[model samples]
Target chain A: MARKLYELAHSRAGDKGDVLMLSLIPYEEEMYEKLREQVTADRVKSHLNHIVKGDVIRYEMPNISALQFVCQGALLGGVTTSLGMDTHGKTLSYALLEMEVDL
Target chain B: MLRIGSGAGFSGDRIEPAIELAEKGKLDYLVLECLAERTIALAQKRKKADVMLGYDPLLEKRIRSLLPALLKNNVRLVTNMGAANPIGGAQKIIEIAEELGLKVKVAAVTGDDVLPYVFENADSLLFNPELFETASILSANAYMGVSEIVPALETGADVIITGRVADPSLFLAPMIHHFGWSVDDYDLMAKGTVIGHLLECAGQLTGGYFADPKKKDVNGLAYLGFPLAEVQSDGSALLTKVPGTGGTLTLRTVKEQLLYEVMDPSSYITPDVVADFTTVSLREDREDRILLTGGRGKERPAQLKVSVGYDAGFIGEGEITYAGENAYGRAELAGAIVKERISRNYDEFKVDYIGAISGHRGSFGHQVNPYEVRLRVAGKTFEEDKAQRIGEEVEALYTNGPAGGGGARKFVNEVIGIVSTMVPRTVINAAIKVMEVGQNGKETV
Candidate 1:
């Protein structure tokens, strides 16, 4: 059975201009490889297709057991210009966590 | 080892936690990093309105509240609360110190405002065309490095304030001053920079933003504690917070904050160093304490990034709530009415069913059956009147479309768009001015 990303890991979202940086940390250190394998830029880009309008890039932090997804053109022109209520895209991490994953 | 506490993480952070740190936490320095990317631009707007009003609005309140406890504990303060006016901010601090009958030396680090240089070298700057094009520029500030702040600390000033200096550099400067770390020592700079980054967001490191209810519960959130770091000469630090204060400091909180607002962790660029967050390692030293080590840095970037705030028209917003049966449908209907009513007049229009899909923009799909929902309609337009109309349409729903629509609210904000560009590092120069007040309340500069 497939599981939600939230059940296997935790995440946090931050913004820099129109770019959104979302950090994904697995609940257990052993799950790091699984998250890295299943959670790709394409998967995340498709998962947040509505909110993100540009490219998605991923960076790994093996020592910290985490993956950072840098989503471009994600904030509808970011905090200053975005018409959306969540201008900072702070809630998108939960939205990303809603993606289903094979654990 | 130098014990440094964080008084604030942002411009409008809580004041009581900082007071608590000063009153109890044994510390050498308390850094209150209060500037955000768009904040200086907003401050520029205020400075235009009044010459002396551009600094952080809470400067007086924070200074007044923390002065006694800070002085009593000998905890020197280093903050970027100056916003767009470090000199004015320092003067305000001196005034507050005089009012409290306390002797103090406050140093204001200037030269971050690079509007003139930006205009002179506008064509040469690396522009992000997507963010703005020929808009009226409001403010341009270069992120200064530790070189500017060390002199201020060298003056033996009780407080150091700056404007537009990099957030991590605010914490890194004291380490460079106290430990005598060379700027070229990239590894040490990286290590210190990581320490700065970790403690910069005071409460976040203490689980302020980490609460997930049953999944990731954090206790005492009402009075959440702020973070502090005990730095060793070798560049490793022990991160913790005041005991018995609200919030938990664990590996989970530390992990989350380590990458907060960070992009490309291997090359987290700052004016002082290019810190590699990938090299960092965290260990639980004991209860409420995490020992962090293994941060590395590379040579600093040749050019400094400048944040430019420009006038970007206006944002008009309106929201109305609907509850009871078929609340989502009512809210959706209300949104359709507003969009049909006036969306064609604006350059950009957005309709959001607040409870159903506003935040994710329908990416997560709609809630099956929401008990209540808010209909929000917003737009971007050049004219203020056009912006104001977005809210007017939604408010009309109280009588026209939705039966249960209530609590209508409207807002129109003059939009300021913040974009980034890179300028030669040499174009930026940092200068410091020291102000003092004696116990007798005589002021000197």
Candidate 2:
């Protein structure tokens, strides 16, 4: 399902100069803790290498819950095609909602 | 007493409509209210982000077009569209007047946006530490009284733009300033405030929101007519709308608007007067006008009230319907099963049972018989995910329940977080000052 969503978003943007940020939350709390032990920031960065181009890939772990992946500059034509707005302000909100990862 | 006019909710052509009516109808004062509560909140958010440019940059363009007509018609304008950027609003109006070669003095009334003041004094004022935690402080506006506006008018500003003056005070100020109506003249000022309230929403009283079904059918009703208050020196006023407009002005419509948006009907307080609505009487006049007579006003309150919001915990709820021999009993059983499942997963959870059909049995006026029941279960937890899980469990009840036929149908769930904050009440202690400038001087009124 995650790969399908990625493919759909990629097809919509024509996959040129687009960056994809994938945010995932493991089903169980212990599963995330185990994944944390196995995956370092560099390994996660390498895993996301296919999606990252010129922009940076950032990871954030909110204290309450959830791990968020932020991909920049990968969106084709930036925000105009992504969120239908020409501003960086409105596009940021659309990008956050688009990268949904369900565990 | 100063004679001031106050009204709200205006758009397009700025003061031309008011000035035209004032000139053609020979009105003594004109007040326009353009800021809604939500507009103030949005403006405050912009100000906090340091993007406060001016109150609607388009306002000056509209005002520029209307100045010549306003000056020729001798209509003094007061409005609360200034939002959090009154200074910016004033400067733009001044620039327009200069460009048009109209010597109009513009005075801006400030100190209404209280976000900075509240933040500075939060430590001493707020009782709870959590009150200052979250940033939901969209806007902080002061409900200024008539006393503040009279002085700015006295300063001889032909156009006065304010932040968040109370809706009625705009009308009352011109009356109190021109007529010398005493603060204790509650009966007279109350009449003025009532007049202001009726005319506040423009066409609202004049058939815009009238209860008459025919008003809904009236053609060209979309371009609502603005209100006009004809005040007498004795404190009696006539409320009417712009001429040749497609709307009704009736006592019933005026009374309905008087009761709308107000918390207490008896003590409807403005800056200059605390009006007792019970004393007001509305009479339909010859034209599309309502004569407001005998409103009892009283001393203004000491402290001005402010509204604030804070962060609260998250909540989620789901509902399902049960129809069977023992529908109510089965609904209760379904709630218990969901509670048990949620408790096994999380230790801290708040659960509530809401029954929608419990009152229907008594209100239907028929012999009570077996009927279907709708049960709603809502749970609140610190963790948002746990709240979502509770919603999932409630949805699963249709397949898993006692009798294998709880008949749980049409399940719906929603999750929402609460924001808790208090609006600290304060007093506008500044004394009223009225300064007069000559008509030929830089300031022209």
Candidate 3:
């Protein structure tokens, strides 16, 4: 169920060129394999066509659990674009938390 | 006489005396020690409660009054009050200074709070599985050395705020910055590092933790007045206390501070140097002052040590005791029975029986006599349910033993499980980005 949810969210996120970085607390190698099986680079690239251009996607597995995703270029012209307003970054962080990942 | 000032970790203590001595008595720098392990945890909780406004408000309130006075007197301030949030602490200081209308350039050295970043890139960051398993890290605070703070000093920062930096770094940074010492200059940096180690604990260098020879008048010593360091451009430093301060600066006090957290006296690694503590020498310089000199250091390591955390398994423990005529035998039998019961019920459980008993010396000056014994059984089960089951079995041991009717029944059961999966470890990795921005215009150190 978690894997399916992660795949759907990841695919949706990938359509917009935003890379998903997954970190598992007390990192387990099995999680990396599970993620690889759930989502592919091509599928993520296809999703990116719906969002923004020049977005870099990255997947990271830190020694800790809990995944992290960096959505570069997705917030272009957003509040963080000026660096004066931190709202855009906060919003994106909140949105990322809302993303569902399949176990 | 060389004048110096030091600050302690508790609250309600004022920095006024330290300030007066620094300004009026011509002291070189003032050192304040704040952050502790528990304090960091508290600050983290408070920060989480209000992310927009970081840290407890009291630190800012007290520091606001001291900033203007310290800046006016030209007494440099170094402290670890930055806790887990140095950047936020720096911003707060900047805000407070701006509010007071004081143009104090504040320099904050970060890269210490790498918990968020490490969590962001855990899988790609860690290579070892065992590193993740054994460590149940709650907080991974990067222990930054002092070299980074030098740039802030060069940038003309009157007040420098930093996160979980080594206690010695606060003192070493000012020496490095003021003397323009090179990183590879092991001898000079080692001398500064020694000065830092001496003054890091504030009152500890004075009579606070010292063993007085007379043992008289030691009880009247106050906690507020701490020791200070007067560092020269020549890379030498002197330790002294403020005038009218209650503490005494003896060779005993200085020696105690030197040996505080040091694991190895010969090779004490600091941000400045791998110092040789064995070569250090000290002498009393008049009343309330001690001269510290002669510390040799080696080159610093290339990488910074980062703390990382991961998950570990759950654990539970329970203890029960038995007492009666054959207390020793009964205790032993009771332990065996309990273990047997647990083994029968649960496949995965660890049990340990620890205690001492006095038995009869059959043929000696004493006739056959029994002694009392206390048996403590502790075990851990992976499953919480299984732990509870084991707890029930241990509790029932008291009523079902050979000495059941008269045996003592005091059992404690604690269930332990992985509530969350996060353990912290220190990893020494390659350098990231190095940019030196100081008053002299950004130059790479």
Candidate 4:
């Protein structure tokens, strides 16, 4: 079945330097492996191509059933220099959560 | 077991919750994490104008409001509220205690200020050394660890003030000092660091900012309880908040916070240790209580991360609102006209349709335009007058260009921010000073 990532998981956004770190956790603990297989760096990179300027790195946490994506060059110039109203990219997590995931 | 209560999460956090924690939480230590990356830089700018006024703006109110209860309940404090001036902040706290006729001891940790070292080694910054040469650096501070702060707490000081220490170290130091934990114990340090991270945001773990409607509804949000950690001698912790307080403590909330600002699950770097959260596990023992275990750590990083704040020109921002039919078109036209007016004066300017694609352009798809939208234009310039022109141009759109532009708002800000760099550990020389009242009820440092 195809469903929005938000319906399957919950995520939060944080920033450091010019990178936007988004943590994605499945709503049900049993779906951890499914996310590990589907939410690859390439998949996420393709998902947020317009939002991110550089490469994306994904770190997996099997025990916690969470995945963290560090999207580089995603904040324009980051908190200090970015002219965008969403300076810290606090809402970028929603863009990732809006992606369609197959379960 | 040690009960560590989180008081204030940031510089402007609510004060009343902290008092409640001190008076009723039955805590052994109270830790407040208030300093952010650019906070000290702004405080330094204020200190440049007047020497005695560079600490946290809410320092007096936070301390004065909580002093009576804190002293009465025998709760000790550890904080980085000394934004740009630890000595001045310490002196101010002591003076406050004296005015209330309460005996108290104060301690200040020093040597995080690396402004001189930065100027000397700007060209040799470990990463991106080139940025420092051209950056008009304002303040450079190194993140200190438990090394200096732990000793200061050993002096039995009622309160400790510090500059830029890692947020987690505020909660971890007292644990290290009280439990006599080995400084080289990586596993324990990692566990403590994780607890610190959870409590550092204070109310976030206790539901200050995590309430979502329908999906994750939280109860009694207005009186949300702050977080506290009941840490064991074996480096495990149970995270919870006060009883009958608003906000829910659940596995969902803890998981979200665990990864907050963390780069890698295997190597989360801090001055004290490289905390690895890869195999960490958590389970709810009961309602509003989560038990955390299995944190691992590696050797500490040799170079400490330094946050260098510098002047970054000025930001001029202006906004205007349009409503009813064709509002999006009118707002777009208003944005274009303002851009045309200010483009000549500014080298670069950005126009964002606040209510439209400014935030969610990607996922929102190509739907019909919003009935009403806000148009905002922001520009950066070296000259204040030129920065002023961006807003002035936007304000002119109401009478001169747009038909129904209302609620026009504008502002100009002197932008200053922190740039990250790493310096060798040998260069940092952190110190600590403890003060107490003598036999005559006079304070001594």
Best by lDDT: 1
lDDT order, best first, reads: 1, 4, 2, 3
Better of 3 and 4 by TM-score: 4
Q: Chain B alone, TM-score of each model? A: 0.97, 0.67, 0.65, 0.97
The 0-to-1 C-alpha lDDT of every candidate, in the order given, reads 0.89, 0.54, 0.52, 0.86
Second chain of candidate 1: TM-score?
A: 0.97
lDDT of 3 at B6: 65
Chain A TM-score compared with the true chain A, each model in order: 0.97, 0.44, 0.40, 0.96
Over 4 Å off, model 4: B126-135, B366-368, B437-439
Report the C-alpha displacement of residue B236, candidate 3, in angstroms: 2.6
Q: DockQ, per-model, please?
A: 0.86, 0.01, 0.01, 0.72
lDDT of 1: 0.89
**What would the per-residue lDDT of candidate 4 be over residues A1-103, giving only the tens digit for each residue?**
8988878888889999789999999889898898888889999998888888898999988878899999899988778877888988988888898788787
TM-scores for all candidates?
0.97, 0.56, 0.55, 0.97
Top-DockQ structure, candidate number: 1
Docking class of 1: high
Taking chain A of model 1 alone, its TM-score versus the true chain A equals 0.97
lDDT tens digits by residue: candidate 1, B21-111: 9988898999998998888999999999999989999999999999998888899999999999999999999888887888999999998
Better of 1 and 4 by DockQ: 1
The DockQ of predicted model 4 stands at 0.72
lDDT for each residue of candidate 2 in B96-204, tens digit (9 for 90 to 100): 7666667776777876666666566666545554634542344545677777777877776787788777777776777777877776777777877877776676666
Candidate 4 lDDT, B241-286, residue by residue in tens: 8887888899989998998888787898888889999868899999
Where is model 2 more than 4 Å wrong at Cα?
A1-103, B1-25, B48-54, B120-132, B136-138, B211-220, B309-445
